[model samples]
Target chain A: MILERQLRDELKQYASSQQCPPDMHARLRQQMEQAMGKGAFRPARFRRGVMAAAISAALLLPAAAFAGNPMLADRIYGSFEQLKKKMTAVTMEQYAALAGKLSGAQAQLGEKEYARYEALLKQYVRAAYEYGNGKGYIDFDALPAEKRAEMKQLLRELQPYFDRLNGERSAKEVLSPEAFDRYIEAQMTYQTVLAQAGIEAGQRFTSQDIPAHLRDRFEKAEAVIREVSRATDPRR
Target chain B: MNEWEVQQLLKRLAAGDLAAFDRIYEMTFQDVYRTLSLLLVNRGDIEDVMNEVYVGMWLSLPRYDPGRPFRYWLHGLIVRKAQDWRRKAWRRLRLLKRANWAKGTDGWTDDSVLAAETRQEVLTLVRRLPYKLRVVIILRYYHDYTLEEMAELLQIPLGTVKSRHHHALKKLRRQLEERPQGKVASTDDLGTTTT
Candidate 1:
């Protein structure tokens, strides 16, 4: 009983000192907005009619047809090109491959700081990558209702970008041709990873963030995006 | 807000009310953070996990029983999410070929003194306990769940929770016993997580 009391008291102290990030609600609100989409929460009867119509339209359309706006795709691709320089890759495997490039940066850090920074980086990547890749993670079709609803609670600023890669998504803000959409979304997601990494890395990583190996991924992901753009070009 | 009011907010939330979400978040974000902080030692994972927990709450809101206290329901969801997060973390480790990040955290957990003069220091020792044992301690002490409650929330047998609680306290007691002369002991074996 005494041991239990001591443990409880210690835990209570830790709990008292804890606080959440200030901007957590605002960020959540923004993500929920994107996930639900505008006009999605209309009256149930209206929603039913619209959903039925969508289903009908989907059935009528050719299997080759893809959803999303070219203009939006352009903006997404443009953003990726710009974002390539600022951040890192999506998975640890991707980053590990680029370890050599970050050696100079690692050399500057004290052992403890590097440990803390690297630990934070992994968490940041996992969180932001999971958050941004919400719908994309499941490919929409595979996501259970509970799982899909969970994604609705996460960041979806890259909804359109994620949709293309994941397959059969309904976002007006997307690019077309399943293959091309996949490419654009992949690059956008990569940039988003780097962008989140910048936040986690703080001053040091942001200052010396760009490594040649990561840059190659940028070129490849962007090159794919650009190629898709040319293929989807209305003028061509 | 009272349970009734929170239930009403949850209703609105299910209807896609962002205002209700914002309000519920205001009331519960601290608890959410504390619950996660206890479960996950990494500060960074807490923020991201908070995102999952809140969203999980929203998704799970439909099934929430208004008769029960909201806090317990929320804690249940948080524990489940942390479990999911831990599983994913192991998977994430596989992808990270050179998991040097795993370095600073893993050191000595074999017969290390955990005499902590300060509260934070002592808690660090608690954090060092293996994940299974550490979680039982946190759930029982920090979250204040009854053994039966933890068993229910964790979907494990009650006896297992009992044994783990006993095992953890025994491990902790061995470490918390101060060395002679009040001299500080080396932390070589004090790293979090032991087999």
Candidate 2:
């Protein structure tokens, strides 16, 4: 009991001495005010409108529109290559912008629209994967004619929506450049630390391997990916 | 502010009074900040997490139940947020590794410098504990949470809480005994071995 008491006392003393910086409250208050002013707390009707727009845009892609075209296989391969390159080259700024737009879409989307978007994205990923394995190079001629035609139709149907979703116009419509830049910078720092740790893309590591400081930023960026995955889950 | 006062402030906040939100922030910022600091060792993260906590508070005010202790709710949010943050970080790190990008060595901040510089042996040992054990110890000792409260706050079983607390103390005791301090003795010598 003596040792336990002593340990507790020592811990209490140490915890008591720990103080938050004096300016923390002021800074937090300012941020809260800014967020409120930007309708961060308000229900996002604008987000629903954007979701509606995206859904309408997606609905316009008729699979039959490009079905059975021999040249369709080449087009699908081209589009998949373009998307892979775009995803690879996405800067922190672009990612933040994309993430912000996604969050808005998540907030506003109805059950039907969400399900549609989810199915479309899943189909797009599968098509892209089969076409090029998510890497840049794809052998268009190697695919059988019927399979090629189907892949081409899927790509033609999905590519425009993907482009609009990832494009700057969509991101800029929802996120201010300043917020996008700030989030991106934080993301860059997080990615840099992961690189230093010799962690590769899609590799798994325990939380212990992460440095204490970068964890928050790392988590924020991860939330973006998770949000996308959750929205795109076919089961959902 | 007392529980009653806090509830009143929360009521005002629910009614969209920004001043009440400010008051609540002022009242609880220290405890919230300290709790986050202990849970997350990185000083930079503490501030960001703190900002997130208040924003979360504002967004969640409409769901607040005045009957329960506000501090309890706040602590629960902080713990959940911290865990979520850690989980996300781990996932992102994995994703980066899979991409086969060159290792980014630049811009990594040294967090040891940001962690509390404690010379006290006990404090150092507590800090060195694994994150799960450390959080249990901090909640028990620093925040004065009872074993039941700790279990509830952490959403774990009561037996699990007791085991973690027992294990943490045992580890600390063993470490202290191993040190060369003459006055500090073993658990056997002190006769304070907890079951």
Candidate 3:
């Protein structure tokens, strides 16, 4: 009991001495104000209110105008398609640039580098849509056996980049080495899950086949990718 | 700021008052930053995570209950964001490793080196604990959270929290008692004292 009390007191003393950066409050306030100004920090209720108003305004628009001008609807649809294509192109460019950098670099990257890598990975699904011979699928099985083998070999070649990226990222974000190792182990488990489900790189799988925890991770990964895609969309 | 003041600020923030948001930021940034610094090794990442936490809080403020402790909610959000950052980092690293990329050391800033040099031995050991135990210790000692509070915050049973706390202290005690005199062992993860 005495030892525990002593340890607690020592810890309390240490905690009291820890201080944040002197400029943290000022910087955070600036960021919060900026975010609020941009509507990025708007409460959900405000967004919903705005959305409701927009919907109401749209409903009030003349139905006769749309009925008389079929070309108007066509134009809107065409513009939407064009915007999507533009977004896909931008996302692809961003991913390709980051992936190329990772491919060429020999050294472990900093947080910025790891963030770029993450943003690139998040675009992987979109890249499949943009680059997969216009078939909207990453048809690895469609390739000749030799080509498939080459693709696998290329993935193998990229493994070290992934490892080093993890090492640097783990070093940056995770305080505990043991926790970082568990994260790596979780990645391995994800791979095992994929293998068991007969899923290969660039292939999609049914969410139902994934374990619950792994499925959550997979969904989060997709969400990150989608978020990156939206953030980089030129039309946005 | 007290809970009542924070709640008032949050109410104004939810009403779209930028000044209220700024006030909340001023009141809570230190606590948030300190918590993040202890959790994240990379100073740059800590700043990023801190920004993310604020943004997340702002986005979810409508659902926040004024009756609840704002600090607890904010801490929970920070923990979740940090975990997300960690997972993303791990995923990218695993991909690089699978590609056979040679691992190299990241370049450190002068500030980071100085910070590492100043880290206390006990803090270093605390950081070496497994994640589950480390979080419990950090909350109990660093944040001054009660064990019951920790159990509720972590969504774990009280028994689990007590077990983790016990295991963490035992590990710390063993590490301290077993150290040889005049020979300080280097910890790679703590980024401390070893060039």
- Candidate number of the best lDDT: 2
Candidate 3 on A1-236: residue-level lDDT in tens? 43344445555555566576566556667666676777754311110001101111111111111112322222222332442353332222222222333333322466566455434442443333343333122334455667545534433333334435333221213224454333333333344344344433322235765667667755554343233323322233
lDDT of 2 by residue, B1-195 (tens): 599989888888766677987899888887887777677643334655676688788888777777677777888888877765543331121122111112231111123332345555676666667767878878877777888888877779988888888788788888888877534644654322232
Stretches of candidate 3 exceeding 4 Å from the true structure: A1-19, A22-27, A37-236, B91-116, B182-195
TM-score of each: 0.50, 0.50, 0.48
Candidate 3 or 2, higher TM-score: 2
At residue B137, give the lDDT of candidate 3.
70
Note the residue pairs that clash in candidate 1.
A87-A194, A88-A194, B108-B189, B128-B192
Taken over the whole model, the C-alpha lDDT of each candidate is 0.49, 0.52, 0.48
DockQ of every model listed? 0.17, 0.12, 0.08
The deviation in Å at residue B131 for candidate 1 is 2.6
**Residues B29-52 of candidate 3: C-alpha lDDT, one tens digit per residue:** 777877776665434356657767
What docking grade does candidate 2 earn? incorrect
**Candidate 2 chain B, poorest ten consecutive residues by summed lDDT:** B90-99
Q: Per-residue lDDT of A137-211 in model 2, one digit per residue for the tens?
A: 233445677875664455434333442443213322334556434333333344445544434332325555677
Q: Report the candidate with higher lDDT, 2 versus 3.
A: 2
Off by over 4 Å in 1: A38-236, B90-119, B178-195
Q: Supply the global lDDT for candidate 2.
A: 0.52
Q: Name the 10 consecutive residues with the lowest summed lDDT in model 1 chain A.
A: A44-53
Better of 1 and 2 by lDDT: 2
